[model samples]
Target: MKLLLTSAGIMNKSIHDTLVDMLDKPIGESSALCIPTAMYGHPWVGPGVQAWEFIKGDARNPMVNLGWKSVGVLELTALPSINKDRWVSLVQETDVLLVAGGDPLYLCYWMQQSGLADLLPSLRSVYVGMSAGSMVMAPHIGEYFVGWNPPNDSDETLNLVDFAMFPHVDHEMLPHNTMAHAEKWAADIQGPAYAIDDETAIKVIDGAVEVISEGNWKLFSS
Candidate 1:
């Protein structure tokens, strides 16, 4: 699967261009499934209006509002109770998966329980993740980002990527997510990591990693 991991959503033209490049098509021609599963697990975010905004593409950052050929909600929490055949083909047919920000661990839990984690390796769609959604692709989110504890009680995530990420670095709204804070988090992570602001995104294709940024980002080697 192609990965376009963003601190925020596709917030700038550079990121937007990269996403289109990854898709190899115009935004209007693509089909997308927006996953709002992570929002419900976050203490500060959802089970309310925020989740609605993201689905409606009226949130602070872009994702679902990109004017795709079609946009559907694929709530991970709902998948376990339903038959896999009902949704598996739908997922396989989609052009992209738009994962929203919230608690990465919580999202990881549902992704596992819903069977999506296992299916990821077979997907042809581009996976576009915002904040925690992007962070969850890493081996670990580190202790600072842990909010909704998983059943295993680990800060570990999907391990889809070799490095961890500290997102929203130095954003005015999230004052605590500074570069210094990211450094501290990286020390505990003890691995390759990135500190990225809203305008930065990491693109991964065939195991190669590239940082595309209009704002600021730093890579800390393990």
Candidate 2:
């Protein structure tokens, strides 16, 4: 499996350029699966609306500059009820699985509840995880204490890959407490932990892990 784990949305031109260059695929050929149910303050609503417009060709969307030809955005607001027939079909047909930014604990819970967490790893598609999407790929979801509610119970994660990732490390653009919250959680987890700063990514292709861009990353093991 090819995994593109990003810290956040392509927040600017340089990052977007890097993504386009790395994937080497047209925007129309790829599909983004937006999981917003985990986000608080209605995070998914804005992106969902914009993604729909971007793919469907409406000027009002934020992603219009991407110029992707065919984009399918699904609003997975809750587990069990979220994964409808349409989302299932999209997952099966899409060339890429783009997991968007949201609350990590919420995303993990919904992912397991919806059964997609198990199914995603098996699909022969490129997996793109942004923000919380990247965090859940880890063995534990506790590292995402910032901008997310803490997890109450220990649950099995996707385990598609071996290492746990912390995206947007030192993301000063966000609220001041984001990194502090994440740092506290990071100190508690035991395993191979990765702290990735914004505008950076880790590309794992066939079990080979490599830093893909300009940023800082740290590996922690206990």
Candidate 3:
């Protein structure tokens, strides 16, 4: 699987062009699935209008609005009730997966529960993650980012990548998301980590990692 992990969605031209490059096809010709399960688990977001906005592509982050040929919902919470063959084919056939942001642990739990975590390795789809959606790809989100708790009470996530991330760094609205705070968070993480602003994205292809940014980002080496 290919990854274009963003602090926000495609918020700038560079990230947009990079996404298009990763697709190897025009955005209008591709099919996508938006996963809104993470929003439901977050207190600030919800099982309300925020989730609707993301699915409808009306959210602050530009995701589903990228003009895919077709866009559908792949709610991880709903997959467990249905048979595997039903949605697995849908996921494999899709060109990309637009995963929304909310709470990292919440998204991680559902991914594991719905078997999406297990299925991700075999799929060819490009993963486009926003905020917490991107954070969940790491081995650990660190204690600071843990909102909705999993049953085992671990801060651990999917381990899809080798590093951790701190999103929305220094945003005016989020006073606690400063670079200093991120440094403190990274101390507990004790591994490679990145603190990124909204205009930054981390791209991964064939195990090679690259920083695609129009804004600022800092990589804290392990």
lDDT of 3 by residue, 50-72 (tens): 99999999647999998899999
Q: CA lDDT of 158 in candidate 3?
A: 95
lDDT (tens digit, per residue) of candidate 1 on 113-136: 999999987899999999999999
Which candidate do you rate higher for TM-score, 1 or 2?
1
Clashes of each: 0, 1, 0
User: After best superposition, candidate 3 residue 57: deviation in angstroms?
Assistant: 0.4
Q: Candidate 3 clash total?
A: 0
Q: Rate the local accuracy (lDDT) of all candidates.
A: 0.94, 0.61, 0.94
lDDT of 1: 0.94
TM-score of each: 0.98, 0.73, 0.98
Per-residue lDDT of candidate 2, residues 1-222 (tens digit): 567777765554555664565556866665555444444423553445643443344332123235555555544545476536656767766666666556666677767667777777667666767677777777775534534443655634567677777677776655543545556656777767677777577777788887766666666665
Which residue pairs in candidate 3 have backbone atoms (N, alpha carbon, C) closer than 3 angstroms, thus clashing?
none
Name the 10 consecutive residues with the lowest summed lDDT in model 3.
58-67
